[model samples]
Target: MRRDIGGVVRNSLLAGAALLAGCAGTVNAPYPPIRADLSPAALARGATIFHASCEACHRGGDAETVSGAPLRELPSYMGRFHASNLTSHPTAGIGSATDAELARAIRYAVSRDGRLMVMPSYGMGDADLAAVLGFMRSGHPLFAPDSRPAPRSEFSFIGGMGFRVITGNEPVERPASGIPVPPKAATREYGRYMAHDVYDCASCHTDGYSPRKTEGDDVFAGGMAFVDPEGRKVHSSNITFHETGLAHWTLEDFTRAVRDGIAPDGSVLRSPMPRFRGLDAVEAQALYDYLRSVPARDNEVKGARPRLTATSVRPAWVAATGAETTVQGTTVGAPPEGSATAPGHGPQQNNVASTTSQGPAGGTATAARPPSPGNASDGDGVTAPASPAAAQGSSVNTAAAPARKPRPAAPKVDAPKLFVQLGCASCHGPGARYQDRLAGVANRSEAELVRWVRNPEQFLPGTPMPTYAELIDEPTARALVRWVKAGGPASLSSTSR
Candidate 1:
């Protein structure tokens, strides 16, 4: 009886493993071609929805700036479960996506075969889903034509090992289905769907699993980190409603920072957060709205580093100098006595190597020397002219002659009007006492204003101020800095008048 029972359990385990393998392999099925011709208005609405929802992870405008995977290039980038391009291209674009397929992908997170999909089922309302389909069929160029392989299973090894251990049987082999479906959509009730579903903003901006539970109100408090190619860590700020978030920022200030990479304090933000140089006025506004609506939390993150000083030089610089000494071994002459290293340039040289290496006046060696006049012969025996005019022309041609397309002018954004549209005044203006306090802070400098805008928790940790890290990019941050330094509405109006 005991042996019989053990055999039965083994068989049951094998059956379960087989079932899981089947589920994993057949997740993605071919989508049916879109049949209905969507109207222009529908397409326009879809575009707006896409900007608010999908753009964050996909394209984020034509700047090619990407925080998540690019949906436009999905057909080419995603390995197995490739997202079809939504452009009018003949072969791979979503011009062929059926309304049914679009609906299935959005609301149910299922493919045409009733299989689960890998997409996040976050913010897709019925209207927004329909709008996204319309935009997909709107005949716009979403991506270039390219074939993409399906994504490989990340859990295959675990499944195989588990099958071996439990059932004493080989794991079933099958093609992996990359489709993923959530039990329910988080943003479906709201009209905004694309940002939540396709872009999957909550995956990073909010803590995993129960984001609401972790962040009751603080939406973006800026503590996420990304490692660069050089292995330096870059963190994402928290965008929440606590005093540490972007509670003090204005809408225009938020827009400029995202589009331009300029901080609220007029400082440049580093790369990886690409500048949204290609976004038009309408797209920017929609994104702004979606971000404003995200629930704010109260997470107080550390402030940015204080200004760099001589003592604050990165360890990499020190290492490089030390390495040079060991390898070159003083072949590079030391600096002359009493000569100090220039501020921006590295250490000074002690002795001049050649007559042409004469030091500049004021005991500083001219770091870079002007090219020689007239023609000269090279060590390789090639004769070259040293005409400064020709050199200058070549430099200009190299530097300035790229055939770059002209960027469109940014639309003028009115902070006061936007504040009203987004109902910011409900908590910030006359009805609330918050306006009085903000008004009193008007005389602060741009830096001071930025400190308050970036995070209010430093001054008042318990106060309610949403961090705008997700919503407000660098440029928009700077604009808020300008506005705050100018004293919000009163200063703005005075300048306008």
Candidate 2:
């Protein structure tokens, strides 16, 4: 009888082990169909969403960030975190992942191997879901197949307990049907979708743990707490229509703030606040409309740095420099393969590498690029000059610029603009590894900061930063550093900068 009982117990244990194995992968399976599209407009929308949401963590390095390249660390996560390669490479990326798998991962924050992740976005509407995925799979140069290798995330003891044990297997209801999004337009409906569903705007703007909200009394009113990649606690400012928020802000002010990282009060926005230079005018206006339409909240966020104080304002010394003052700009993180605008490709030495209709001060600027040998630009250092008729329709087919007439090279810009337009922000921008270095710019004396800015190689040898001593004068560098020292960089693009 004792032997019989032992056999039964052994059988029960084996059965339990088999059951656990089966349950793991099926936890978030049977992902519904999204019916994504590969249209140019869809690709553009995907690029926009990717820029606003995914670029911060999934970046490969300081160079033009290729999507799907793995990053090894996150801010204070106490884990060997590696942002998974999101590219479509057959082995190195998510190329093998089925559409349903992608859907489940996005919806449930579950990894392909069944590990729960802490993704900022989950369960977007169907239209947007289709567009974003379509763009990723459309073989665009940014998301095209790449075989770069990086390690996967390895959680520590505490992290394992927090994510896997406590929050990992929570029983949240999955959507039985597809979520719906608004029509593409400059309307509040689409704007709401952008803020909540696609890329969460309040992720940093909220102080609470549950920052993601679809509809709330206080969405963009601020008080969001963020720990930068360097493990610093950064305060998020209120951005509502209240006097304490954006009550005094105009559309142009809001546009410049997002595109250039400058504030209405003249203070520069700090790092971790994404600078989205490629954000189109329609998207900007739509987002602004939604923010204005939200209920006014009186929360005055504190501990936020670079508040544009009277002391931190542009010093009078700028006038003595006898050079022009400048402001900010940038493009999305991902650049197409062989892109002329990619870092090391464009005329960055001139301090004016790119031009966009989206200007630093919320104006339009036609790019004057060097002429390519052929009639069109084939990912070369050229933009085919459009005729009057072609320029109007450029909005529809904006992603691809093929063979066209060549334009002249752009004239040189000032040193301050060079800092952003030349891609300096990628290494020092929001959540960048070296972002901590910018704080010293505010603390050090004028001459010290100026010296470092003029020739960063002098302060730190073997640095990758380009030397600007020849381009900028002592007074100019001094004034420029003082002017921008209040805030850290967000991001600058090769195309938009």
Candidate 3:
């Protein structure tokens, strides 16, 4: 009837020490060392990875001048989880952490002092890992010393106990040797690598990120739960190409949704889903290929997305080619506000409303820079300045971000093209179930129509029609609205083609 109190305490201490040892084991050989890359090229690649993956949390729309702000302050059952300072500042940032310590923190999900920090387990290859770590230490101005004060992560007692039980099984093993990156292609193999390894999409998409998920099974079927910084719990979408998932989402649709955070049905993605507008066309298509290749299960994630705080105002972060990022002070370039697509550029993909496309060009559709979201844009993602001036044309006052050149502009979105580009025709087009969707458009006032184009959610709270805020400016929306009001061009097929 008596408890072995001393023995229990001794055993608890031993267990804790063992777990801490496992957490710190990632710094040794076989796991790529932090000393591998500090060259400009390596740092650049690291910057790209950070922008595409880490920026959603770390950058959180903060301009470069703002001392690294406490990005997210999540209140979960696990306790207060604050996004830590990643800058080079000695105390308030990672400057005090050794390279090995940072690597352990990032890949092993263990802090320097060896406590659990609920970060996604990274499976980055040797080269990629080296680059990212190198960038963190490369003295880049964006990551320059920022002594921003931020709250430290503190886990609840229950949460800490749960983490010990759940993650106590040593983390997934790092590669014994460098895991080379797959070739960049739309092939299922590369796509699979990109989805799971590069983007770590599976980390959130897989329900609870269950460790024993079967590849090509329901792992990518979604339902992984997340609590936004505001404490709103939302389930990740079932992205497999199943009936309840993307269904017939074209590659283009997938791209638009991910890059711009707009859904095909016009619903905007919520916080925690960074519009990876930074992904280039090929990279995006690779993800699409991977998703389509996976097994699809029916798991509908139904709920209103929690509103965002630090997203939407995305300043550039090691820019790739999403519509919202900037390079140095330049916008990567868009047309003047409310202006037509610039002369050399085709049509601005940013537009009034709709979803994505993976048309006849195969999954190789030209990458479209998203139109910067207007301040009034809806949803849980973006709140870019309304003016094209902030992010259009040859000059912009963007944050200090460096990058490879922007991708070529998307093809024009004239009335006929626009009609199909936004997936608008899919519902109202000839074969759709609702050709009458625009039946009364001719009677609506131009202002009302413009509003509809810019923000369909205002009219229909859960409409699948997304806003053109990140794709087109007001004028283009007005033009499209006028075109829709006029019954669309007679020559155009009601079909999206």
Candidate 4:
């Protein structure tokens, strides 16, 4: 017999309630101490880390994936635990969280009560964690106003379910080493490092960027999507060499877009692409250097459209009715000429025997007929050749769906070529004021660098940084992480193993 996995799990949990009786003991652990005066640099780093890592599941109040829940406006029904709103709301937010508590949550995924938190713990380092804490302490509110019901004890079930789904009994862990620091110098190697690892420029922009299929071209031509809590969908845009891409965008334009979510047109990019607003001058310049060196692809993609209604509510019978409607020459009202018995024929001769009987009035039935040799119209008005071979072939063709065409390749660009086409050197030049700042940070670990690159807001709460998460993906983030952790050098390629 087939077993229902979810039902079985639910039943087992209910049966083992005694084992989980005291799981809620740590629900009211004391908040950590707060440091109100965090430096700009530290806040900037924190912001980046938050975007690259935290925002994947917490942006715009909703987690990007289904299992993840909304962070903002969390219903009290979810009190088993919620990703506390990171904004500076003192009464119910992370504004009062101590740096140590923040660090524990980030790197260790552990709450003050020593219980595991269900946050993703990838690419975090000591300095980076501290920077995030400093940034959070810097007093910036990212959420809009919304009141939810007060949390309750029963909500712990939600936390338990989340733990089962997201944590899977895993213990909290941290990065093995201290955060690496970058040097003060302008090097091609460093530029590549910042682009590939720190900022994760290649993640969502490249097609087939997985470790197994990393050879495809089309760098920076975006096509990524995220689902919101209410089931809305958002897509990443193309940033390539094509005219419709970011071809005309200046480095400043790109920078502003990444850090602020403000497009060149002055529009706010929607959720999941968190506003950076936290990057410092040095980190921004480093990102600029890397973007300049990337090869450009010309792939153009359509912007996002509204999501479809929930599948559950859609009419199930509509599909069957539609399929029947599309069969050529078939009609419910008409019957075929030869199949209809003459008026004088008896009831037995008049009724074409159906293989499956239909219920009286509301009954259902299946109708089958012996093979015919000549082209003929069925009583249902569907014109089919009576020949068995032809009918079989037609049925097969209808059943075997047509194949789809392969998607076109994305554009590609070499490092130096991209620098020239995009005019990156205008702000990131050697000896330039901005260049000196980026040079100082060429050696930060990939995780730290990516934090800065994706969004700077987590660190510098009110600073001006742009979000690059739209232009990158997880794989590219990993690649950049390797490059940054290895000292932000081109020769230090780190695409997994």
Which one wins on TM-score? 3
Show where candidate 4 strays beyond 4 Å.
1-69, 72-82, 85-101, 108-125, 135-176, 184-223, 228-231, 238-248, 265-267, 280-282, 291-497
- TM-score of each prediction: 0.39, 0.57, 0.58, 0.38
- Span of ten consecutive residues with least summed lDDT in model 1: 324-333
lDDT order, best first, reads 3, 2, 4, 1
Who is ahead in lDDT, 3 or 4?
A: 3
How close to the true structure is residue 227 of candidate 4, measured as C-alpha lDDT?
Answer: 43
Q: Candidate 1: list runs displaced more than 4 Å.
A: 1-37, 51-96, 112-114, 143-203, 209-236, 259-261, 266-296, 300-497
Q: Which ten residues in a row have the lowest lDDT in candidate 4?
A: 325-334
In model 1, what is the error at residue 442, expressed in angstroms?
46
Most accurate candidate by lDDT = 3
Using alpha carbons, what is the TM-score of model 4? 0.38
Any idea what lDDT model 2 has? 0.56
What are the per-residue Cα lDDT tens digits for candidate 2 across 1-497? 99999999998767655543332323544465765668888777766666556665666444243444333323455466567677778778888888767776766667777656555545577767777788668876555666875476655545444443434354235573557777768999877777666657765565554423424677777876566444566667887777667776778667767755555544446556765645668888898999899888887777643233223332111122222223332211111323232122232222422445343444243443554433344322235665665555544565576764333242323434545543455556555566666766667886677667655544532233444443343434544565567562543333332
The per-prediction tally of clashing pairs is 67, 11, 23, 38
The residue-by-residue lDDT of candidate 4 on 1-497, one tens digit each, is: 14688888878888545334434334323332333227787776766665554544443322221122344323344353345455544444454556667655654455655665534333333555567666556544443322332232243565455444433344433344464535534544554444443444555455431321113565666665444333455455666535546656656555666665655443335444544454455656666665555566655566621111222121111022112110011111112223332222222311222334332222233333433445564332234565676657554455567774322111111223222212222223343223344554546654565556544444443332344333322223334444334433333222210
After superposition, candidate 2 runs with Cα above 4 Å error: 1-26, 63-74, 164-168, 171-177, 211-218, 229-231, 265-268, 305-497
1 or 2, which is superior by TM-score?
2
Listed per candidate, the RMSD to the true structure in angstroms reads 22.3, 16.3, 16.7, 28.0
- Full-model lDDT for every candidate: 0.40, 0.56, 0.58, 0.42
